[model samples]
Target: MTYTVNCSILLTELPLLERPAAAKAAGFDAVEFWWPFESSVPSDSETTAFERAITDAGVQLSGLNFNAGNMPGGDRGLVSWVGREGEFKDNIDVVAGIGERLGCTAFNALYGNRQEEFSPEEQDELAARNLAAAAEGVARIGGTVLLEPVSGAPRYPLLKAQHALDVIARVKAESGAQNIKLLADFYHLAVNGDDVAAVIEKHAKDFGHIQIADNPGRGAPGTGELPLGEWIARSRELGYDGYIGLEYKEPQETAFSWAIREHAAN
Candidate 1:
């Protein structure tokens, strides 16, 4: 039951140093960044600077996002596994190297949406192949990659957790790799009408990590329709010991920070 920060909110604003400091001020002990390595943070200096931030803030780097279509000329949101297999392998290797160096072993994997013209089944198979290879590369660096499903996003063809589980099952059955697991984001689940608790309990074996944001507006835990307490209670009931990632945008810095602090204090 650790509180962690998802630095997506700082993607455009906030200097990298201020990101961790903000988390610390809010009483969080862990932080995660979405593709921070690819941003202005230099490859050689990023790790050292990031490590200092963590120490200064008394927090840890939870993990890094592999990449997303949000970046210009990025994979366009489907992981580009269908036709860009070589680049996929290369990207995984690069991220894995960074993960090993930064003491971050977990990563978020989403299939960036492909062109609508591609067959859904074809895209699925391509993603499956790419993930299997990515898993192998991640394992070499003592890490694991979690496949996250982005529902309600026009770009995602496989937009459900169950569907991602099916793909993971098939990949495991075919390649015998267990390094790959499910990364469930409550925000997407709420939009797609998935039962967060039930999915977590029923498919606990397939889950490696979790992210959270309120429904509708994608705000803080207490800001929207998500029953944060219920999910936390059920998660604890179901024996989930992994980090609960806070991925959301705050209207103001501490609008809901007090809620998290109170929750932690309690």
Candidate 2:
């Protein structure tokens, strides 16, 4: 089966309510948002309208970005999960509810980077505990949580793919939640100078979705050095059928449409 291309609305620069329509106009089968609560328009009302627009446009919402660091800086600052268990549970419940209502089956999140000097073991333990808690909540709703690896994030203290996989395995084992998965951001892979297909092959079992953009400059395809068509073909050869989110900053407004068509043609 052909993999569905989900346009990352966050990279589209379009307002939440208008994103779904615009993505459909651009020929994407699905649209993804960062966090609905952060919409420029009224949260509740705009979210509902956003849903309607997607349905009207016949676009599916494949995933959401959950939340960002403490609003200012830090990695995700899933800070709410740090000391207050109740608060963390409530937050996940709310986000999961929103995801369910919006038709998002996967929610990508950063585990609030451990920006301080904590023992490597301690950091992993904290991440494992937090992920376990979050995964349990997600599993209750049949939703999956995707842990993303970003540069300079403590959550990825061990930046290499092998280390990341080990951590992920431990987290899933401890969490007792098999619904959790990995979000393979190809941009990061390129930055690390790793062979994207090799890494994907190594972690295909844990990987659920992929976000792609060219290296050096995280720009749309054709404007960068990545051979996206070859990568897509490799993925297909491996029997991987999943959404490939188009998340990148376009050099020009007209560039995105051209890029998407180019990518689709491949």
Candidate 3:
């Protein structure tokens, strides 16, 4: 099985720039991250340090998020925010540069929440255009822009696979970009009441990427009742060959026993 540690969530005990090395030392050859900087356009010195961390650590940067503002502050993303479109657009070159430098090809774009000042139609329209722009920029590196259905944000409209797929279709039609795809995160889909099995059974072949955290607590797999091993095995049976991102929150030391348990069961 191919697995990549999501350093942004799992390695909270370490400083951000140190996470890729930590992940490499933990036996993972690949790692992923959310936007690693606060500013949309980080200085060259900052980016240079970041790239150095990954290269020195000998780890592949598997996936990254487009600048999603203040994720810990309840902001999901910037694409649909009417006043921040410039920031989102400007961040694309940085995201593309990172992807190209690291040979990373999958990028997630979390759709911004529904703003009170705008109608749903207004937000959706803005999202499609912005997502198309993101897709086009990433496409230059042979990358795919991912749309993920998130849980725990009431204002976020995408809570299921189809919701994201609809936006993917919209972006393709509007911009003639075919580089967009759904990021099927089982934990979010299950928490939001979607039939996760049916989703994987029907569309696993098309998923841009997959992420997992145990249900109920969003912890590592063994801490919850989710049949994650079976689901992942099934997804493999259905031809999803991409890395399964371990995007759970837990103590890094004991977090991966679940993988060993799942492997024994398989």
Candidate 4:
């Protein structure tokens, strides 16, 4: 039952730079995060502090996201956006740089939502190119690029396992990229009405990373209706050997107790 706390979402009780240490104090030696900086290309000092925070706390940076562009302001991602292609391209090397610095190898690229400005076909064409560049950039570090199908963002196009898989296939075939893979987030899949068991039984091994949260409420393991323990076990049984990322909403103090107790019982 190996786990990595999603510091970006989990330890919000503390400041950003302090969450890695907080995760360590909570008994997790590994952590993941969304883009930690507001800017895609952060200054040298900002980059140094983030890298040092992870290293100094003695926690592995298990996963990270490329800049998704003002998430709080209703932007989801730039990969498929109409006019932000260069920004997405610019952030590629920066993401690779940070990943290189922290020895982190997994990177998530959110597929931007469908836009009226550009046709869906146009957005997807651009996404293939951007995702290729992303894959190539991180390929230098022996990294895998992750594409997730998330819920709650209605305009965001990638919402099902097959939807993301279709894009992965296109990226590989159209752009000759092999490093791009699926980020199978169970809570999102379930919420989007995907057959979680079918995704696991068929494509569990296709995942580059796995995130979990209880469904119906998007909380920690015991706070909702998901059979999260069985899901993890079944994923393992089907050959997924990566860390199970705790990407959910809950109070910081009580967040890890559920995972700790589950681990002990197992």
Candidate 5:
């Protein structure tokens, strides 16, 4: 039941290269992040520099996301989006390469928002195909593909745990690869009004990773109503021993007292 900080959400005031060090300073020995580069296929220099930053920070890289179109903008993901398959595929090798360098095995692949031009069936078909390919590519490095149900975007089809699991099953059956698993994010589940505890009890064994942010504000664990600490303990009771990613928003200079408290309590 160790913890890893998500630099993409925490420590936004610092430069990307410095975030790993910041997390380390905050008592975190591991961290995860979304795609840092704007380009799907960044140059070797950029990739190397990123790897160096993490290595020099002396923290383990726990998880990384495959390229999702424009995160800061409105794009939820790109792999399932029509006409963006090429770009999404182009990022697989890059992500896998970095994952190999960082000793990171968990990789999240976001299912893109629904497109009006494409029917639901078309999107599902495309997602399954692309996810299968992604699963295969990451398998070369002994990496696992993570499917997460995101909140706040209605157009995104995978908003419920069942939907994400269904997609994972489809990809596995279609690709004959078993490296795909679920990324259970409690905040997203609670935000969508699902019984988070019930979902965890049923799918804990299927989870490859877990992330958390409190409901109402998507902030730190203690900032909202979710009993994240209890939920985390429950997850461990159910046999999930993986890192719990702290994927929550925080002020630029806020202290991670909540994490310290949780660690002490555990």
Candidate 6:
């Protein structure tokens, strides 16, 4: 049950290229992130620099998200958007290429916010098609495509774990790709009023990756009421030995004390 720091959320005070090293300095040997660059299809130079940063940092890349549009500005995702499918498709190769270079095997594809112009059925259809394509691309590299359920964003659908799992089933059935898996993000599920324990107990076998943040404020463990440590223990008991991504928010310098404690105990 090793842990991976999420550079996109943690160590954000540092420049994007420096976060991986910062994560390593804090005792993490592996890290994950959302799309770090502004553009999904960055230039060759930009791509090379990003790869170099991770290599120089000496940390394994654990997981990455496909472009989710303007994440900070409230665009939950774009893969499922009607006019944005092309962009999502274009970014798949880029994400897969980077993941392959970094030895990353988990890729998350966010189901975009529901557009008023498009009916729910229409959006689901588009999402299925795009996710299928993404699954195919990542499968070529022996990577698993992850479906995550986000919370507190009404416009974005798939706020519940079941919703994301249903979509995973749909993508698998449609594409006949068996590498599709669930990314069980406890923070999002708790925010959406889910019984995190029950969900984990029922669906842990289907999960390929897991992320954590204490709820009520999306803070690090122990800052909130979430029993994150307990849940993690339960997950391990359920036969999940993969990386547990630390996807919380805190001051960069002090963010890893809890993880340090865990490491020491181990």
Top-TM-score structure, candidate number: 4
Tens-place lDDT digits, model 1, residues 99-200: 776577887777777667778778877777777887888898778878877765566656678877888898898888888888878788768877777787
Q: Rate the local accuracy (lDDT) of all candidates.
A: 0.72, 0.64, 0.92, 0.92, 0.90, 0.89
- What digit string (tens of lDDT, one per residue) describes model 3 on residues 39-72? 8999999999988999999999999999999998
Estimate the overall C-alpha local distance difference test score of candidate 6: 0.89
By summed lDDT, which 10 consecutive residues of candidate 6 come out lowest? 253-262
Number of clashes in model 4? Answer: 0
Q: What's model 4's overall lDDT?
A: 0.92
TM-score of every model versus the real structure = 0.86, 0.82, 0.97, 0.98, 0.97, 0.97
Q: Over the stretch 111-205, how does candidate 4's per-residue lDDT look in tens digits?
A: 98889888999999999999999999999999999999989998998989999999999999998999999999999999999998899999987
**Which is the winner by TM-score between candidate 4 and candidate 6?**
4
Model 6 superposed RMSD (Cα): 1.1
The residue-by-residue lDDT of candidate 6 on 29-77, one tens digit each, is: 9999898778879999998998898899999999999999899888888
Positional deviation of residue 231's Cα in model 5 after best superposition, in angstroms: 1.3
**Tens digits of per-residue lDDT for model 2, 1-266:** 23333444343465557667767675667877665554212356755675687689788878875555343345454522345444445567666766677667787766555545556566567767766777776676678877766654545454455555666688777756787777777777677766777976766545777777776577666668887767766765676577877777663365466555767887
Q: Candidate 2 at 11: error in angstroms? A: 5.5
TM-score of 4: 0.98
Clash pairs (backbone) in predicted model 5: none
RMSD of 4: 0.9
**Ten contiguous residues minimizing lDDT sum, candidate 5:** 252-261
The residue-level lDDT of candidate 3 at 98 comes to 95
Better of 2 and 5 by lDDT: 5
Name model 5 segments beyond 4 Å from true.
Answer: 263-266
